[model samples]
Target: MTITENAPAGAATGADGVEHVDVLVIGAGVSGIDAGHHLRERFPDKTFAILEKMPGRGGTWWTHRFPGARSDSDLFTYGYAHKPWRGPSIATSEEITNYLDEVIEEDDLKAAIRYRHEVTAASWSSSDHRWTLDVLRGDTGETVRMTCDFLWMCQGYYNHQDPYRPEWPGMEDFRGVIVHPQTWPEDLDWEGKRVVVIGSGATAATVVPAMAEKAAHVTMLQRTPTFVAAVPKTHELAVQLRALDIPEDWTHEILRRAYIEQFNELTRMCLETPEEARQFLLGEMRPYLPEGYDVEKDFNPGYRPWQQRIAVVPDGDIFTAIKEGRASVVTDTIDTFTETGIRTSSGQELEADIVVSATGFNLSALGDIPFTVDDEPVDVSQAVTWRGIMISGIPNMAYVFGYFRHSWTLRADLVSDLVCRLLAHMEAKGATTVTPTLRPEDADMEIRPWSDPENFNSGYVMRSQHKMFKQGDRAPWTHMHEYAEERHTLPAADLDDGSLQYR
Candidate 1:
């Protein structure tokens, strides 16, 4: 089988216009950019294009520009394997966007990006061995059609257009400003205002400290406490490596590996020793709080450490704000919204002039793009995911999903590498398509949740679990959240493991 460009003669134009490519990458996020880079480097002969819904590059970083918006994960792990992060460990939205722009310029991927092309629907044709995508062009309301041999869903799993906001009783009665962090008003004045931030997650953790700096007093109102840790703003290992006359790329690689291994160990500890891990984490929080403060009531979460994402604060900013009396935390249920503030279930009335709902995201899968396989609408909830990349019966398609336990890009790099390898395998076989074909014996196997029912109880995961594909009880069918397990198993995974069928 020799690799060469092949366009089917049956390919025809749709009502608006039609374009064909070897690979169609959806969204211009970090995952999409990595897919583009991998395709260019590994399969130069194959034609591909990236479709981004936003007006420009940087999907999450571009859209989320709220006050104190930064990554919960460190930069070394979040940054791509090909690109070394030169900024601080935890990067702000602007810094991240700038890094993405630099990556686009450095790799010269701007030409292949079709900005404002939002994919609304995708249909797979088994007979044609291609995917037809209906894309909505932002400039014009017209829907354009794009056909590709392989469909890569690089859009990160979450609905960026809408965030989750619970309806509160008497919320309308409040006379002050109410803002959700997702769509923060750019010109809104926050200075010297009594601010109340709802929720106790990453968004709330960042917003409380950030608003505390400018506002008269900021109060974080939470139903439950979330585990928060302090990570250094700068990479100490990178600095030490650089001081040792190590090359920039080498230094980055060393620090990246170190962080990955460390996180992997941490995840293991959380799973194997929940009691000890919980106690240790709470102990870490003790020093950051003021004297006589209640650690168990204020810092301890209902769940174990790694059950949900651990929010990282740079230099203990949030703790520092609380210690200095600039910010405060209230752990109680909201009874109702008063005219000037919120009333708690404990009969506590907190006065606030501004309300910031730092509530979590409305999780989404495949960007709500309606999918059809051979004219039959595909239901993702009914299907099983294969290796966290491809759905069991989805032919010639892959999506990027990151690890819940560690850095997102760690799994992303592995997925991209596997995809490039699989593409090469298909080219070697002279095949146009490959799908994860389930065996007859495997069909009767008991289906399990995408994650362990007991271990995976994150609020977002629980809310969106029904929309996501399931996982089987065995290998290749189960998605591994552990980086150490994936690092060893994924590279060595056999394409001919009786699961993948090629044509």
Candidate 2:
């Protein structure tokens, strides 16, 4: 897909010197970059631009400058379907950022991006059939107005500013330095100093092995256990194919399909027989642990597999660190923070010179951008998502939210495809707008949480439940994590399903 030099005719310019385009994509992350490429290919005549809040590209990778920062999912599927990732399965933060930069450079997307331009609010105009956005310039305390035919929210779901850190008594009394992984200090020096990492998620798992290389000792303090698994650097089939001199792109595609298929079956197993799935997952980890190790106590989680994200360690680095006496796991609740250490509820005092809280992030949607419809403020919590992309009563707008079970970009790719179809259909019918509205028969349909609470028990998601959009109990209204179901349904979905109202 090549970028066209010309902008579409009759592009709207708002009252406050607004710059308009055919589409306004709100982010320069993976989703934003993916959407840009698809739009260029699907609608070559239309013009669009990406607004990035950060000074650089790579939304999550750029912002998160923590030590041992890397992807929990493999690069093959986590990567865009259009792009081929030639690196190892698990890539570091810097590596991922560089990959994004490569995409931006090769695809000529840099010209279409405006860094440090944060979109503050977006209001839909019914009369003009457009969206007027209020964007704040990062360098200056000024607002830049913009108008668009459609708004694409490629911003991922997570709060960047404030991460979730629970208050503990005597935290002020702790003499050791406290750090959160989200805001890791650049000049931090922990060499030969005792370190305590809190939480049991992927962040904690990654940091422990990484910091153990320099720190005197690293202790992973967790209130509850999480499912941790080891993944190889490359798929066996890809490795075999490469050995036989198969082309890189072809090998990557083979591996990508294999991973997707494996995960799709795993997702089905989780939904169908959760207990069996949990046992199978634990069984995979048993061989990595020391003899007589309590897999149930340390490796097993309370919830079923895929409910919360499963943590993946590249080549079992964390386990190696523990086995070699460089790191250890302490399963207990923190009673209080003492001057030089933390006291546990079990009356154990763990000495530490530095404490890192890998607690979790605050979940936010549309980059927390305020939205309005026809000059009226839109309450996202009351809105229902149409196939996890378009929201009910929202005109010519779509948000790219990925699958929680599989690699995020898998669903993003599908959403981008559907969006292109929607835009093309609108053009063919001479329609200026398309909005998913609840039908009369759907008035009494039971409204539930966006995801089933039992199947999604992540602390960050549960805490921010009130802020997320709701979903219906039926088809086209539910947000599914199953890639197989979405892969087949979304691309062939009926445009005139009595939900999407066009004008």
Candidate 3:
């Protein structure tokens, strides 16, 4: 199974020239770093390189620079399974990036990564049994060619260049500066200014309280309420473990399991008893707000708990800001942008010097890279996901799409193991490629959305559903399972199953 250093013996080369490897992993974020570690550990004889479009590592963490940008999920599970997170459960972007830096350094993955290589187009040739990639170097204006036997897509699920911002009437008439959290300006100042944050998602929840500290006043304007819960920055048990002089790795493993069990129970409760779960969430939120605040008006969501995602505020910081009169919440649709502020449908004028649009982002399928199989373009929407890792009709390629309800890295780590196992299986079978194909018996299986709207319908997912791959109603083709289910199913999944065609 040993592969040559730069050029595999059987791989093809382009006319100009091309570099070839056994595996080419896309992105240098959490998932890519994990993939690097697995490849080095399990298959030292194989040659692979990681490609990243940005100038540095940390895909999402590096891209998001807005005020108060942090992880909404607890770091215990969000952190890589092999690494120990010693910081607070909810960490800032800088802290997360530093953690990634340590992982890259400790695992000797820095030399295997190319910082400015961006894959623009990929074409697969069945005869050659290889993939030729067209990569544009961000550092230079030139495009380079490369080839690989296997492609691992870990570029993330969202479009980092553009964010979703709704068009409101009279936007041109407004004189205030409008900013989107995705592209937060470096020189913009909000101190001593009237600030208004639009939308009630995680971004808005993080920005409002952070800006309220210095802004003359801040208003969180939302069309509808979102379920919000307050969580401690540091887990109580983690502190106790440190007090006992327990080893860091021991503490990490114990807390990781504890958090996973706790979240699994919460998710199950939300699914089985919607009313009770909703009541419990609301009850938890009530103690954080002012004694007589109208929780029903500003905090109660139209949907049940975990319908989309519950925004987590560290130490009830957002509520504390509201209780101190530094910030306020107004739930109403925008009528139009006034000369200096925004006007609500209720005829109330909310004046502001600056506005932050914390609307969601756009989903990118396979990093929006154009693909061709033997000169035929690939429309990803028409295909079905195979075990939520490989797509039907796509050969020698597997992608990392994480869970929406849980920490993304949970699924990322699981998929890494599955991909490594599949690679080993292929090598043992002496196969050049493997593709997911629908059997004749599966012809009549119902095709459903990638994620069922009933289970979790976030705005970004619903807005981009038509562009995502489809899922079948049968085994090995469906992926709407929870982390607890996937943790077991993915590892024990039969690689010899008929759904995967080996050549």
Candidate 4:
């Protein structure tokens, strides 16, 4: 690792030819964009640059090219707090990327972003109060170094390059094409082919109906059922607000708040009266299914409502495909992969020409980047998160990990606000470094998993729990709270509460 002298603020290069900035943001995704916007708007004198691993902006949207790729959360809450989302509630990846493009162009953020630059390792020097990042340029194999006073990690929580694909029995013997949604092949044709999608999550819910459009038949094979709700493609209130000629910003805020309230109410209902919430969720899908279709066998989940994420089917399109006989659902465990297709444990063989593993993604801890503090390697999983943003023992670094029950961007925006506030506070104190430290009172606090499995047990979270940071039983140490609570608590969080050590 190359160490250089810390350059003054706003200086692009230091004496040793190392590029330096006030802040270095990792990833140009949703969180990164929001961070960039807030830093520019709140602190115009600060120099920062967004380093994106992909060749362009729209991190996940640009990376995921699977059919029917869209957001499970409504765009109103999923979009940036500053930008107005004028599109429908459920939007495709294209629409999302387009909206992100508008934000990039309108804010003149193109110049501040360096695309195709991936950060391999980040080393922080306490002596100099700066972070040195070893970045690799994708277009060229050459490696470059950049230093920053503060590191804003917005690379998201999942591995974009390597998705979680389980090795099934006889996968090598399968003659049909097997594809994972994260890395969809551009030239692989699925039209007029029998397709079988494994897993019943949002990706499967989206892909099944989409492939059914031209595929001979699409089968959604799942080991267990998931709570699926049919939401309107366009929100009713959004239509009314637009009809009244309300300004875009006003509509965005109104819809954003409305969705937050609705989500909170549903969450409360699920927690307080789980049986009623379960029945209600199941009842909502009954009308969308074909007559005589066994909803309990396929749509009814084993767990209570909100235990995991509920997949939202826009306008009941997946159900419509099932009703039209273009697609079908099979709830069973896979025995093995035959030369033709998958053979379920029930001894039934379903032949297919293509198989899509819409299972899930591997959770990436801090973009899977190696880190070092004062030349000593740091293991992130051993550290605890401070307000779900900064990690314990790491100085001048903050990450954006969003809420699972609500839209990810909602917390992203909140974190941006908190980070900006923290930066301003640091400036006011004339402190060059700030770290979330364990207080004397916190030493005895119970250390828990990053998220309580009982509260939210999504497959991705459960499978990767060992790789995530831990949370404590106290305030500012816990991070898995709902957005309804954090929306206020985060803004009002005391920075000088002795939880953070500054110098």
Candidate 5:
């Protein structure tokens, strides 16, 4: 493991090393690291580079240095499968970011990381089967169009764009500072002000409780109720088990497995039997609210549990905050923003000193890049997800994306191992490039019916559902809701294949 640290403190880098690499992995997030690590493992002689846009690595971790940002899922399943997360049960944004840094350090991946080299666009040449990337370095203000054999897009949907703020009727009239949880403004002071959080997703859930800890009053505004699920890191059995000679690594693995197993089944149940799922979810939520609070009205979502993402409360801590009157959930759609507060559709205007939009992210398809095949434009929008790994008709391009239902890294890890297998298959067959085309059966788009409907709000699902790479079959094939099953599909599989057209 050799890490070459040439990146000085800046946003971009200029022309320096123009050496040819076999693969160019864009975005140095969990996906990018997997791409590089897997590529290096499968094709030991092949060279790859991770071009990160930020001055440093850690995509969302670095970009979103928000005050109360943390993982909604357990940290055990959040990081690289090879490297476990050595932090508290629920990892803070700082912890996850630091873990990613540690991954880079442990694997010596920094040498190949071209930090601040933001890729603007990628063009693939058909005759040469190579991708030419136009990248801008933040520090040097230098732009270079580098060439590579294959393009591995690890840039998760979210980019450095401002969140979408709807035109609330009197929003422009509000004198207070309006903020989106995505692009947080660090210097803003909300010490003792009344803060109203918009939307009912995990972001809002995360912000409200943490803000209530400091703010005078934190109001969580929701158009529809969001299903809240609370799971503790240590149950009675796990607590007793941890006291023995059980290693922290093994303990985390077991906890990650157990939680993923439960969430996976819960997601499937929500999709298959929505009403039953709703009833089950409400059963869990009812105990958190006070007397006379309608579970169906305040906590029951219009959709099934996984239909929209079930908000993780981390031991029902957020509900406790609300239970203690530190936080309140107002179930109403925002009619508009007033100078002093937000007015709901029910004609009630609440006073607020600050308004935060936790309204989800736009479908950011692989860093919003236009992919080309053999110099001709290959429409990715037209492709179907080949088990959510490789795109049809496009040769040697892999995209790393995660499930909204399960941990993001679980799927990424699968794709990483699959990439390794595909590389080995290509090497054994003496093929320069491999494209996994969709079988005739997967030509239509039904979304496999298992993927969390919240993905509809995700940037990838919004923009690229029409793509051939979108999974047709849900879990075990296209979707992996469990860690144990994913291990069977990923790092454990053989790379030999008959799907390639050899050179």
Candidate 6:
């Protein structure tokens, strides 16, 4: 993608007061910002800076302004590991963004942020025992280089590509207004327009009902159906959390443990027997659907539950919208866009005044850092993971890995803790660097799709590091498909047989 106006520019040329830092963090999105805070707390007086590509903070939140944009995960689980979200179960985009802004404000992270600067490339320097980075500030269009002893990749997955628009035959020539939920335009006029939301994942599920509030007609178009689960956005526990008067970091830890346990049990039930899992999920969700609704077409998934992150909404409001006839569903693959509307593979064409391509995000790792191990683009697919935290060949780096089959913030918190723990160990040992390597046997397992293969391009599944590992000893110890497994696998203390080499 060519550079656009949204990109930030470097401030000034001279590094007069720039000096050097113990770490150079990239991107101020959730992962980057959260990691930067942890780094600061763990090692104060060690100067570090967060280099963001945008004019402001909020990585995916800032970039994706789609209609009805909100978090799929409950706010209780979606936020930072160190700072808990105080209100509601699921939060709106605006609310979440506000939460992040507050985190930045309270921490006094503004001074450490170098906004508008995107790291174009970074390489490990053997001689200097640090990493050299080349940055381009979109605002100024100036190139600046930076160096840091340790480079951390916290830029989350959603940064890579624009929302995908399949070249469904004649989509390019469709006469309707086509938009992606990821990059929604605020000025867009969807009022009273006939709208069709494409894809069956969370994005499609989210946009249809939200737009139905104003659009004259709303129709959801799905390639394959996904399992739907509904829970309330407000609960007693949330009220208790807000009233606790506990410190933010302590609150973060308590809620973090609670969610880790909740999601882990569900994962275990699913992996114990796929049938029992499906039955349990169906039992919990089937009653909410309209009378006589077919679970097979509407919710029965061919892939295992949690195989694709299940879509969650508040109290099945989407179904309520459909039941009230404000919205409807169409299960068919899109063939092409016609002059009037979309022609699906089922020989049906749905007319629409505006079409939303909620097709999902692409898998681009390391934010925008295009790496070359030896003058060749490093193929992340071909690389092996060292317990899903660090890649085998990369040195002086630790990739941020989110949760699957569990809460995302749960694993991220663990990764942040481990990074701090490791750094403290290095500090005690008087070491300059530490890199974890995967053992020969540990790297031999066959890789499986972390999410559904059909969802290979969707951001939630694709944009993340995709590899699974066994953890600890005995039956429950193996992390086949539960949050407990991850809880066991990722510990603040040394747990794994890691190859911790120092330079």
Q: lDDT by residue for model 5 over 1-503, one digit each (tens)?
A: 22224531121322554445677888898789877677665666676788988887777877776667878877777766677655666777788888888877777687889888888877766677667788898889988777777778898867467465556788889978889887788788888999999888888888888888888888998888788887664354457657785876777678777767877787678767888888887888778777777777778876546755678877787888888898888898888888899889998877888889888766566677776776677666555455566666777787887876678888888887777767676677778866665444544536553234453443334444444234555322355344545656566543434333345
Output the lDDT of residue 294, model 3. 91
Mark the regions of model 5 whose C-alpha exceeds 4 Å error after superposition: 1-17, 40-42, 233-239, 438-499
Point out where model 1 deviates above 4 Å: 1-17
Worst 10 residues of 3 by lDDT: 1-10
Instruction: List the global CA lDDT of all models.
Output: 0.86, 0.88, 0.91, 0.92, 0.72, 0.70
Q: Rank the candidates by TM-score, best first.
A: 4, 3, 2, 1, 5, 6
lDDT of 3 at 402: 87
Off by over 4 Å in 3: 1-16
Candidate 5 weakest lDDT stretch, 10 residues: 2-11
Error of 3 at 364 (Å): 0.8
Please count the clashing residue pairs in each candidate, in the order shown: 0, 0, 0, 0, 20, 10
- Where does candidate 4 stray beyond 4 Å? 1-11
lDDT tens readout by residue for model 6, 1-503:
22222222222222342235567777787777788778767777666778888888888778867777777776666787557677677788788889989988877787778888888887775566777678897878988777677777878766445545577788768888988876776789989899998888888888888899999989999878787777776755556755877765666567656665676677666656768888777877767667777767767777877667788877787887887888888888888888888988989979999998888876556775766543456555555455556654566677675764455665667777877777777778788866655445544455444333432233444445352222322221222233465555567335334555676
How displaced is residue 472 in candidate 5, in Å?
Answer: 5.7
Sliding window of 10 residues with minimal summed lDDT for model 4: 1-10
By summed lDDT, which 10 consecutive residues of candidate 2 come out lowest? Answer: 1-10
On TM-score, who's better, 1 or 4? 4
184-252, model 2: which lDDT tens digit per residue? Answer: 899999999999999999999999999999999999999999999888856677678878988878877
- Prediction 1 TM-score vs. true: 0.96
Give the clashing pairs for model 6: 8-138, 8-139, 9-137, 9-138, 9-139, 9-140, 75-89, 89-233, 264-483, 361-459
Q: What lDDT tens digits, residue by residue, belong to model 1 across residues 1-503? A: 22222322223344445678788899898899989889878877777888999997877877787789999888888998899888788889888888888888886677788889999999999998999999999989889788899999889976888888889999999999999888888998989999999999989999999999999999999999988888788878877877788887887788888888778777888999988988988888889999889989978988878888888899889999999999999999999999999999999999999999988888788888899999999898899988899998889999999877687888888999999999999999999989997887697777887667587787778888788889998878888558888888889889988899999
